[model samples]
Target chain A: MSEMREATFLILTALADEVRHGYGIVQEVSALSEGRVALLPGTLYAALDRLAAQGLVERDREEVVEGRLRRYYRLAEHGRTALAAESARLRQLSTAADARLRTLRPRSV
Target chain B: MRRLLFFYPRAYRRDRGPEILETLQEYAGTSRTRLAVNLIRHGLRTRLGRPASRTVVVWAALFTVACGLFAAAFGSWVGWQTIRPLHESEAAQVAAELLPTQNLKVDTDEPPAKFVIYGQPLGWYSVRDLLLGDGGEYGQSGVGAGSNGPADHPERDLATLRENLRRGGWEFREYVRPDYGHEVYAGRGDQQLDITFYEYNYGASYISLGMDRPAPALATVGGVLGFLAGAVGGFLLFGWASRRTRSVFVKLLLGFGLFFWWAPIVLAFPQMVEHHLSEWHYSWHPLWEWLGQPALSLPFLLGTGLLVLALAISALARAQVRRADDPVPG
Candidate 1:
């Protein structure tokens, strides 16, 4: 399996709980990353297309409101498993870095 | 902003166009350029994203090249025919007047294939028959290949030839255009001769005589029959194309039919129509003669056909997008 991209990871994480439409995913991903990562519609859709092709996320449904289509996407079981693996990988790396930082602290402190 | 969607291939736009437009409408304000660029890139990606798309592209390219080759071949053939006054009976007769073989130095103890066309001494490479037949021998020197004919026909002056033909009741049918090579045509009593005098290569001017003038009724009937056959062929080809266009093999056949038959149809039909309508000598005119040459005609037709094929593909591609079903089907 390939490593999950940051935006893709966040997007999958956003949909881990429930289904979300394009705008909803963008909003949730932004909030999940604390505004550090904003998902542009173009990048978001491109990744969504790729992820869908990989069977990671699927279109849940589509609805037309105010003459505009809103397509919803949901994380599949495969996507959830992939996300769990990626999160664990990040946690392990962060834990090692934190332990190393502890040693570099000022001795006087 | 929606217009930016046009940058995508038609099929891509069709499949996800509505969804994409809705997204761009709501979110693409400050970053519209980036969004547009990304969409354009993805659109192009999807257009050639599949094996089917690649196949279509390859076939189209092959067809384009085939069109060029067909043009070159047809042009040279037509040019060769034009240089000979085959259509001008009087000219063939003047040539026939010299038949059974012309005066030659008889160099190298090699005798040219001597034949009589309306009694003219017409000498051409023996291999001409072989080339026309199953034989593929190309070792012999080509006719008019190196401009071996005299600066003019050696036996007679242009004036003397013309007067001789006229006195023999032959009428001037064709001549080299001003300052062009000394080519002339004349005919009398169902016989025609075409003469070309090469200035540098003295003592030989290519000459041919023939009695190929069929009755006007026969010619018209032949043209009509040929047109009918062509129409049937065209209809059959169109039917084949309509059946399935995605197959590479089918596309190749379509390409061949379009360039090969399409050219002759475009070229010969108009002349036929005019000939039957006005009952005039439309073909006899010198201006229209070169158009029949294969070298010129083939390329002209193929180039035009390519343009037409491109337009047709573009139209078909656009139409493919409007179905609102699967966008990227083979």
Candidate 2:
């Protein structure tokens, strides 16, 4: 499979631990990215629909709160596998970059 | 939030509208303009469906361009309706007044119709003839006159005819000499005149005059507007049909329709471009000819029938139901 986009990685990461509603995912993604990635409703829903279509996510349940519909979503088995593979790929890259930076640091000093 | 939800397709809006609205309300402090724009963009995308299929876009684009071209041709035809047809007597009278010698025998033929196939008006009876070898004979109608024999003092006669046309309010452009003949073009208002003189090595020569009208400005303007409208409408309609059905037969019908309709245009466009570049045209050939219209009317009609059938099948098919486990409601 191709490497996951940063936004997709973050979104999948946001859903890794627990099932979340739309706004919950939005808030979590924002916090995960240190307030750098704020997903609007339209963008977030479109991504959710694509993920669900790809079988990476599935509807967990639904509730009514203050006369508004709140639908929750959770990662599926395929999504967990994909997330783990992507995480491993990123960790390897990060470790290699850190080693290179450490070697450059002593020469610069 | 409700107004922004309106941008989504009807089914999608019904399924996920409330959920999306609730989310938008939570982000109430965010820019409404940005939210609205994003909603509109994604809403239109959702209408197309098949999110993972890249070919859907290519098919939609092809359908749109073909539809736009056909609409433009129809608009140009409507514009042509404004022109007044030239009578055979008018052409003969002009020929008689312009001829230098009274002895030259001139014959004038009346135009059968605004457009004709093999000198007759197009009709159901002529469809076979059109589809056969005679298809190339389909052309615009025009009043024409020709001299039976070579003109006496051909060079002097040309000057005399040019002077006579000038006196009769005709504005002459520079004459062109192609492989076949020396041709002079002139215009007065909507009326256009082409005078061609053919000379052979054995001193055999004759003059032919063709009188018609230039394409009206209204046709050009209307054609452009029609193309724009047709393009947008075709794209939306194609998307609607594509998303409404998953049947393989319907997709095949659409493919066949596009092939039949677009093939003639694909063949004729480059040749027409070459013709335009190689010749000095007083008035352009009618719009239909470029589309290979009545000439290729058989295939055009077949394509139309196939598209109608495809759309009918799509209409009869049920819309795809959202899966229970999908996060989006429908």
DockQ of 1: 0.28
**How close to the true structure is residue B184 of candidate 1, measured as C-alpha lDDT?**
56
Worst 10 residues of 1 chain A by lDDT: A38-47
Model 2 sits at a Cα RMSD from the real structure of 7.2
Model 1 misplaced regions, further than 4 Å? B50-330
State the DockQ of every prediction: 0.28, 0.54
Any idea what lDDT model 2 has? 0.81
Off by over 4 Å in 2: A1-11, A17-45, A53-78, A81-109, B1-44, B97-106, B165-171, B174-178, B221-229, B319-330
lDDT of 1 at B265: 41
Clashes of each: 39, 0
Compare the candidates by DockQ and give the number of the best one: 2
Model 1 over residues B109-135: C-alpha lDDT tens digits?
112322222233233653243324312
User: Residues B27-86, candidate 2, lDDT per residue (tens digit)?
Assistant: 867888888877866776676786445466678878999999888888888887777876
